[model samples]
Target: MVFFNKVGKVALGSRLRLMTAIITDDAAKVYELYEADFMPKWFPVFYTLTEEREITITEIANEIGHSQPSVSKIVQEMITAGLVNDNLKTTDKRRNIVALTEKGLILSKKIKLQCIDVEAAVESLISESNHNLWAALEEWEFLLEQKSLFKRVNEQKKMRESQDVQIIEYTPEYQEAFKALNEEWISTYFEMEEADYKALDNPKEYILDKGGKILVALYKNEPVGVCALIKMNDENYDFEMAKMAVSPKAQGKSIGWLLGEAIVKNAKELGASKLYLESNTILKPAINLYHKLGFEKVSGLATPYKRCNIQMELIIK
Candidate 1:
């Protein structure tokens, strides 16, 4: 036995391999002690054929969770040892079926009795363990089937980064993204008006060229939300927060909060003393977000869109 005390803990892969090697070597030694010609590596295929009577190489591979090539190699060795025979299917010459020979059947019966000893030894080892290792292994296999280990790890990574939303300034590459994101919500809630088209289609001319800024939220390097800070021509340093939209797929992931915080920061940086927005009361979530960001409800404000029934403003210090 190798001591891993210096290493402190053994890796999962190494531990599993070591356990398999130890059991295989012990089984091989038992077979040798009994003066049997069979090997431990041959048991899976030999025992399966003995019970199944006749089966194809592919079937054996599938039943035993081994590669077809590996199973085929073992079958070949069995054939060379005169323990099994292979015959081509009469209806399909391409397919070959395998069956145990007389010698194989006799050897299988002897091995069956030996397996009782192996099972007793395994049970004794399990009794010495602090916990039920077999039960733990079964539960682990079930979970792997439900969701693979790789997928579970990726989901954990996504959950951790869900709060880490990133905001980026709009560029020529994101031109289509800005338009698509805005149009998705606008077209869904209400019909797109002429003003909507002008702003969504030509953001550079209407927003950027007029000293306004557009910010896009990025999650995993993909544009998922957008908002624009439009400079108002009024004497006061006030800006209109417009065209805020988060992709439906990314709605519940806090991308909207990130975009809202970013647009406010950008507005303050651009010398704005107040930020105003025009929205519909039907948009309860958006309205709630605005309220959470300290935007106060205000009375009368002129809005070009017919959908604007609610107006709010935030004072920037």
Candidate 2:
């Protein structure tokens, strides 16, 4: 109890396992009292086969929400116990179909009567509890399905890490960082094009001085990411999002997302109606990040960079 209290929510899996063990042990005792030779773990598969008459291993897994391998193992155990038969499909010999045997059918019929009393007993047990554990479990299952624990934890982690990150406007001191960050990613994937050097080598002269903005992300007071909102005189777009890069060490800190978001917000503040971007599909993560930032695929606009094979735009207005 002391350990669980100290660990708090971190012991969720342990608590769930303890609850499952208690319920499973009671089920085993019930089967023993009825003189039934069955394992509590087999109930889900057995019930599914009895209802479906015949189903493939994959189908059983889908129906019971268990992994195919787990369902296959349970089916094999039932087959060994002479309670089920595993047959290959006539049309597709590679596929297996499971069905209850005569022994299984007889046992299922006996269990049907047991289920009536068991359901009532479980309902009474629930009524005895302060809260409806069954309903709470259903809600927990739905919420977990909506967004997994992995994603939820990672979101919290990003939020915590992002607190250490600070987004600031372009300054002369960060000129080298802006150039190096973009050059690192560009050189890693493709050769730095003439247009890349023109803009990266002199961001202030080429971007900021010409009614544009550059945003820098500093992680723990170190420049880790940079992006630019290059103002454009195009009829469709007011700015072109360019030179976005996150240092490899700070990749998972959500700096890229924060920079993109800051760029968008800045563009809107500057009375920009739409933002444009150019990239190659080969850079999947960058393309995905653009999409997440509300950028949609667009064409008909020529680009100076040889590496630009795709173009996307975001409508801020």
Candidate 2, superposed: residue stretches over 4 Å from native: 88-95
lDDT of 1 by residue, 91-209 (tens): 77777889999998888888888888888987898999998888899999999999997787676665677766789999978889999998899889998888888898999999999
Per-residue lDDT tens digits for candidate 2, residues 180-213, read 9999999999999889988988887899899999
Output the lDDT of residue 51, model 1.
88
Give me the candidate number with maximum TM-score.
2
Whole-model lDDT values for every prediction: 0.87, 0.92
Model 1 worst lDDT run, 10 consecutive residues: 1-10
TM-score of each: 0.55, 0.90
> Local error of candidate 2 at 150, Å?
0.6
